[model samples]
Structures are given as C-alpha cells and as structure tokens.
Target: MDRGKKPTTFFANRNNKIYMDLKDIIRENTLRYLPAKSLRRCTSVCREWKLYISTPFFAHNQSNSFHDLSGFFCQSHSSQPSFISLDPIAYGVPDPSLKFLPEPVDIRCSSNGLLCCQGRTGYKAYYICNPVIQQWKKLPKPDANHGCDPALVLVFEPSLLNFVADYKLICAFQSDLDGYEFDIYSSAEGSWRTSGEICFGNRQIVPSTGVHVDGIVYWQSRSTVVAFDLTSERSTLIYSYSSGSLGKVNGKLCSASIQGSKLTIAELSNPYTNTMQMHSKTRAWSVKNVTLNDSVFAGQTDQKSVLFIGGKIVVIRLGSTLISYDTRTNDIKQLATEVDYDPRMIPYVNSLVEV
Candidate 1:
C-alpha cells in the first residue's frame, strides 16, 4: 500500500536473505489439505511453489491431513478398470484403466496411493504403481506363483518421518505343509520371501476379501477371518463370523453386513498382541445400524457389498446404482447409477507417493 514499503506478500528481509512471507506460510499449510492430483498441478505454478510441494515433508503432511474418500476403481475379469469418482473435481487419476503400465493389468490390491496390479503381458508379473504420477515398478516373481487369483493384499501407511513410499505385498497361497503360507514382498528390501508361519487346515480364502489394517492383513474366509501380522510374521485365525464385507473405521477393523435396508456395522476387537483372540471365537459388536429407507436397497440382500471410501459409507447395490451415505453429517448422495456390479470395487486414494 505504501511506496516506501514492500507488500506483505514478500518476506521481512534479514541477513541479506528473504525468508518466507506470511502469505506463503498460510498457503503452505493450506495446500497440504488438497489431494495429490491437485497438488501435482499446483507445482507448475512457480519455482517457489514447486519447491514447496516437492518436499517429502509436505507430501507426508498432505497424506496425514487428508485421507478421505476420493473414488473407486471398479474392475472385473470381463472389463478393464473403470474409475467411479465420488468427487470428480477433487479426486481422480489421470488414467482410470491404468494404460500407462507396460501392459494391461488386473487391479489386485490398493493401499494409500499405490496399486498392486498383476500384469497380463509377461508371466503375469506383479506391478506396483502410483496412478496419480504414472510411475510403476515391476516386482521380481515371488518364490511361489499364487495361481490365478491369489489372496494378495498390499500394505502401505504414509509415515510422518519418511517421505519415500515403501510397501509390502502378501500372497496367501496354498502350502504343502497342510494349508496356506504367505509369500511376502518388501519394497524396502526389494525382494520376496516366504514366511514360516503356516495357516493350517483347508480355508477358502478369497483374494477380493483381503484388507490391510495397521500392520496386519486380514482376509475373509468362508466362515472365519484369518489375520497375518507383518511384524511377527505369523498367521492366526482372528474373528470367525458369517459372510460379510471386511473394512476399517476410525483406525479399527470392522465388518459391514447388509440385509435389504438394514445395514449392520460391527466393530471387531483386533487385538494384535493377544494370541487368545485368534483361538477364541470373539464376537464383533454392532457399533451402528443404518437403514436406507429407499428403493436403492429394495431387494439387494448381498451382505458383502459395503466399501469404505474415505470417511463415507459407500454401497454398490445390485450392480445398477452406487450409493454413498455420509457418516458424519447424515447426508445421502447418489454417486453413480447404471454401474456394473463388480464384487471388488477397490477404494482408491490419490497420492503423490512414488512407486
């Protein structure tokens, strides 16, 4: 405002160097709340802005601050990957089908910003890719070929201390020593190894039913939930329940069961330290029951149709309509219609983490 003074947009100069201005400090904190796709575009605004968004600390901050539902990557054996954006403007990938990979891939598992897809071109090798940035890494073949549909789950948690993304993939394949063994791959070490822990007995585990929470990965079998701890490298039979959708809520593992309009959300006590939880059949308490009093849920009685997309409750009803129920404000919005029902609608989180 004054000719004699510089505007507040610049810094209060000292020691022959200009420090960050008040305006930039506010913007730096604010930009962390934006999605990775938005932040990547903002990097080209200017050199200072590029430097601000390029920092590992900034990426970590943004990941920590905003992990809400972005969208879903719906895929099946019949079709390529299709993105169903819950918020089109705020969250999406550059390529929904992920054509940027070396070859067409089957979307196996997704965690945080990374996707673990098995390539169709070469030996059906596994690939870890970040669709937001179009970066991918082909993993060396595991010690065990998990057949056609392995119970594969990717584990990734953004660390405040580290910015470089690291992940692990666990394949629950059949073992000769009775039942199942985990063929694990670690990105940090860049190698695959098999764990000694064997899940004994015949368990019908589905690949689409696998989910990673905290450090443990759980898969829904025909009648029980089998868990494998990444730290302990052991597999245990955790919670035994009927066929339902397994998901996480507010950092705790929960399962969702839908019978017509009556939706039951059960919060399972996943005690990692207590081995007793594995042996004993502990019940999952129903934390909440939501009734969708509308035609959207008319006769769809599939118990395993709920998906945790961000903080919202997303339900794919009968393969025709996609319903999103707001858990916070009690707002109901139909995200999409005429959608094909692919049992596995992978919840996608757009992030800047490299492959």
Candidate 2:
C-alpha cells in the first residue's frame, strides 16, 4: 500500500459524512415551511420522509408557520363567491381556483380558516370548508325548521390527537312562539341539539355574521349585544352601545359607532372569566372618539360598514370604495381592487388546516 493512497481514503470518508448531514437538514426545513398541497405530494418521495412528516409535532409546527393573512372569501348578490388573495408571496403556492359548489351556496361566516356556508336552494344544507385546501364536509340537517333566514356561526380547530379537525355550528332562528330558539351542532356527537331559548320582549334582528374572540361569539342587535358562550352553551346580553358594528382589535371585543362626524370605538375589558367563558355581567367599555375625514365619505348617502382587519387597521366601506384607518399612525388609505363587484370584505387568515 502506498502512503499517498492512505490520505485519499481518509478525505473521501469525511466528505461522504458531511453530505449526508446536509441532506438531513434540508429535509427538516422543507417539512416545516412547505405548503399543505406540496407537503402532500412529498409523502410519495420516500418511506422515511413520509414518516417524519406524518408526526403530530411536525403537523402542529407546519400549521403555525403557515398561519397568516392569505386572502378573503368574498361574495355579493351580483356575483358568485370568489377568494381574493392579499399576499401571494406568503401563500407560496398556486391559487386553488375553486369556483363551483355542488349547489348554489351563500358564505355566511368564517372562523379559524374555515368558511361556513349554507345551501341557497330547497333543502337547507350547511357546509364547512378550508378554501385553500379545497376540502369540505356537508353537515347534517337540523331537526327543526330554520325558517327563511337563520343566523349561524361556525368554530373550527384542528385536532392534535389525530390529523382530523373538530368544528361546531350554532344556529339562531325565530321560534313559532314569541321568543327565539337556539340549536347547536357538534362534530364529536355527530348530531344537532337544542339549547336554551331567550325571549326578547320585542322581535330582535340578528346579523348573519358574528365576531368570534377567544371562545365567545358576539352579535349586535338593535339595543343590546348578544354574547354566546361556546364552552357552556349559554347566551347572555351585554348592554353596550347599540346600532354599531362589532369587531376584534388586539384581542379585545370592540364596537364602532358612528355619530354626525365622529366615530366612537368602545372596547370591553375583562369580558371573559378565568376559565375562558364569557361573564354574565356586563363589563366596562373604554371609549375613544376619532373625528371622521370628510374625504372618506365622499358625499355618499348610502349606509356604511366597519370591519377590523387585525392589529390597528380598521376598514370602512360604503360601496365599492374602501378606506382603511390605522390607529397607530393615524393614516388613512383606500383599498384597491381589480374586481368589478362590490366585495364584502372580512378579516381572513390562510392556513393548511384540512377538514
């Protein structure tokens, strides 16, 4: 054996080990940052890679890495439902481009990356879907009639025990009697059950969409704000400002009321209990008034709506035009769009959660 050949063998073994270590590091990062659809296709690569991606720890971190504002699911009476992306760079994948539904459906509400929709035609059917993954499941029909229009809210969270997702749907409708009835559907039970009823002295108007903060859902009525506790299945009323829109800003429930030229924002403090349930008693509301910019109105006489787009940004819309107000910087900017129809915008986050 030659002395020069001995040094060559030593260098070859060292380089081979370094190459194997680099391959392992790349595999770990890919599982963490890849989109859901791309990750699904990666499972076919090899058996060891498939096992690593299938773990619960990887799934939880993958979801957190992809959780952010992706786009909005917008629908109006004049046009079909469409999902418009806000940031395509963060999306990291091609648009899902899902346009058709089994039947004509109305997107009523959204929570935790899930959209709650109902059938437009004869039999009343409900659906829960993740638009990015294009996966959906049809809910079982309720026992009692939901009348012509029913108020509904959906809550969804992905399970850590298994890869399956868990969801709940709550419906509020007018009863034949004087009061209103509430029904709740549970995915764990796979059935719909009736909850307690609340009798408002006069008829109350409930909005189609509600703001879900923490575990409580809030809907505004003519005179009071209705609060529903998801954990306890109980409903209560909080006597805050009426005739205003409800939204969540910086993890607090806020209401924006419009006066002649001033916009008043009231935020509720200590609204929930220690166990994360909504308190029955009314809480204090901290109020702040912001003078309106005349340019925002633009001499429009139509009704306007307010929506909180996370953080300090609040959007006000009259028709097709949208004005966004930043609380931190006191800056105002109009949102631009390419669509022809007036989009009903809401705060949305894109995720890899599959139903």
Candidate 3:
C-alpha cells in the first residue's frame, strides 16, 4: 500500500477519463443484454458511467420498459390507509408523497403510466393519476350497474404496447345465497357493462391487489387466479391453487414480471415454506423455485408476502424485515430498516411502491 496516497484518490485518478469508444460499445451492447442490477451497480462505480447510464438515450434502450417502476402499497391504523410512496430501490423506505388524487379510497392501474383512483364512490367516480406526470383526471361514473364488487385491476399489454384498465364493481346485491352480481368497467370507453353472474366463484373473494401485465388483470380470488382482459372484454382462468398452497404476488402486471423477458407467476410455495415458486408463462406450467430464506425470510407470517418490483422479487412478512430477491445474483438481501430490530409497521411493509 502507498502510505502517502489515499485509496479513494488513487482509484478516482485511475478511473477519471471517459473513453468515447468504450462508452459507445457499452451503450450499444447493453441495449441487448444489460442487466438492471448491473446497471444500478455500475452507476455507483464512477460518475462518468453513471451519467451515461442515466442518460435518456441509453435508458430508452434498456431491455425492460419499466426498469425502476414501484407499486404503491397503502396501509393505515384507521380505514384510510396510510398513504406513503415507497421506492423498493430503497426497500420499503418512504419516497415522496403523491399529491394528485384526494385520499384514495380505491385504485386501479395501467401500464401506459396511469393509475385510476376511485374515491369511496366506487366505479362511477374516478381520478386517473399518472405517477410519472404527477397529474390527476377526475371522471364521471358509468351509467351501467355491475353489482357490488369494487375490485379494480389494471392490464398492460406488451405486444400492443397499449394500456388498459378494468373495474370489477358490483352494481346490485341481493340477500340470501343466490349470487352476488357485478359489472366490469373499461377505461378506454369510460363505461360500465354487465359481465354476467359469477356463480362458481366466491363473492367474498374479491381481489384487493392485482397485477396488470400483458393486457390482463391477474387477480387472486381467495384460491383462484382470475384474469380479465380489457381489450377483449373477456375473462379467463390462469391458475387456481388449493387453499394455503400459495399466497398472492404483486407487480404492474406485464410480461416483464416474468423472468428472462418471459411471463411468469411468482408466489410462495406454501404458508410454511420460505421458498418462492415462479411459474414460467407457458402453455405447460414450467416452474422455477427460488429459496429466499437466507436469513431474509424467517418466521410465520413474514415469509409469505411477495411482490415483483422492477426485475426483482420483494418479500415482506409481518414482523419480518424487508428483503429483495436479486435476480442478478439469485440471492436475497436485507434492506436497511428504519431502525435496528424494529418491528415492521403493520401494513407499512405491504405499502411498498417503486415509483
């Protein structure tokens, strides 16, 4: 070691200049195979590299469209969920607050960068809020009635590169055991239509969280996965697991959630295991299992919650610490918590968004 010179100065001097040839090569080669994790790490390597990577020209060429997108998770002690914008890049740490919509009572989203927030009024009234632009659009309710299911889902279709949203709301409700009726609303037409009665499904199993990927709303209904398409105006079945077999997973709903640029479903193995099974999006269910328990997942309820953020899988369980499963290294890392040995705020860990 050179006693006279400091380590920081030595490295900085050695890596100071920007090589145009090297930069061009990296910019070209990375467009086809740039790994998001590597890119983030590279940004911290040096200032010149960070500027090149952060440039709009280079960022546009990245493989995935939504590289750093965050899903907003809201929770509160009262009925109103504590509204906090979270950046999973910071691992559940609070980000800036959203000022566009009035205390959101309900919300649905789209891949084209739009989130529709419905205030306690249900389907009829909504505010289309774009997290990117930080703007809001209040729209009138649809005339048709769809029963009482107020579940909203956003669908992002990649092939079409089009964004669509679906509102699964119930316009009428009847007592007894006949069946609860509801209608699906569309963001394109701004109207509501009857989707017929869902007799086979459980009325009490409406999904609160959903991923809108590839033009379909992937929602978990108690034990089943119901996918509703906004373009086709049709509903299809993706998967239905046995009770306690696997829990829910969240993302913006698109093929990007799938590994290797393919569509896949990521969920827990069981209520007990700390392993997560990612079902590759294919005709034949090709499944890949990743164990995230390396001290990151431990305990009862804290090991089950999982959501796909950017290109990584984030696990947040009750009382457990927040951790992100890095697809780059195939490993899980514990994110810095607000405090040492701090119990995760109830619903706070769940309210993670990467916006």
**Top lDDT model:** 1
Worst 10 residues of 1 by lDDT: 10-19
Ranking by lDDT: 1, 2, 3
Q: Model 3 misses residue 107 by how many Å?
A: 4.1
Model 2 pairs whose backbones collide: none
Alpha-carbon deviation at 267 in model 2, angstroms: 1.1
Rank the candidate models, highest TM-score first: 1, 2, 3
Single out the weakest 10-residue window by summed lDDT for candidate 2: 91-100
Write one digit per residue (lDDT tens) for candidate 3, span 191-224.
6676554434443444344555544555555545
Give me the displacement of residue 200 in model 2, in angstroms: 3.3
Decoy 1 TM-score against native = 0.85
Q: Is candidate 1 or candidate 3 better by TM-score?
A: 1
Highest TM-score: which candidate? 1
The C-alpha stretches of model 2 lying farther than 4 A from their native spots are 1-60, 64-66, 92-100, 257-263, 270-283, 290-304, 308-312, 326-333, 337-343
TM per candidate comes to 0.85, 0.75, 0.52
Task: Assess candidate 3 and give its TM-score to the true structure.
Answer: 0.52
